[model samples]
Target: MTVWYPQIDTSKCSGCGECVIACPNHALAVVSARAVMVIPQQCSYCGVCEVICPTSAIELPFLICFASSDNNKDQVS
Candidate 1:
């Protein structure tokens, strides 16, 4: 199985729900005035949520393979 990790910048985040709604896979949620990913497996890496985030709060840290344990991919938020 493969997975992508998304980092949320709470400082930049303005409590907007765009990312939560933009996530096509329903992998996002709002928790305690903050955004969270409840289902990362559902992420499709479409970059939809990242694009809609007005504060640039959501970011894809890097592309990762659990079996290899090598992380070189870095994407901007």
Candidate 2:
């Protein structure tokens, strides 16, 4: 199964730590003065990090749609 995770853009990131603090799952961390996805499996695709990010460095691709698809698959089985 494909899972959606946040990918950080280093060039745009200011290492503000806003996304790190906002992530409920603690999936993000500061590495080399930039935000990185430290624990990808723990991410719930909730978009909290993306929303909290000030630099727009955190990109969540198809997170909601992928999550909904996973839920539908569970219901069908």
Candidate 3:
């Protein structure tokens, strides 16, 4: 399954590191004077980053898929 991730708007971001600090999963970081998704896989798709961002540079999609089961348990053949 696919997962949603945070999208950083560098134009709005001032590299304040607030999102980085607010991230509970340590998925965000400031690199070269810009906030970036250092560990995309570690992100929990939490909105804390978006909320904590003073510039509103962080945008996390509403839906985040964590698990999926393709196994058909009730196949009517």
Q: Which stretches of candidate 2 lie over 4 Å from their true place?
A: 63-77
lDDT of model 2, residue 60: 84
Error of 2 at 41 (Å): 1.0
| Alpha carbon deviation, residue 66, candidate 1 (Å) | 18
Give the residue spans of candidate 1 off by over 4 A: 63-77
Clashes of each: 0, 0, 0
lDDT of each: 0.79, 0.84, 0.86
The TM-score between candidate 3 and the true structure equals 0.77
Put down candidate 1 lDDT per residue, 1-77, tens digits, no spaces: 44666888888888778999888889888887788888887877788878899989988866633453236336322
Clashing residue pairs, backbone N/CA/C < 3 A, model 1: none
Query: Which digits, one per residue and each the tens of the lDDT, describe model 2 over residues 1-77?
Result: 67678888899999989988998899889998999889888899899988888889888887233334654775532
lDDT computed for candidate 1: 0.79
How high is the lDDT of residue 61 in model 3? Answer: 68
Name the candidate, 1 or 2, with the larger lDDT value: 2
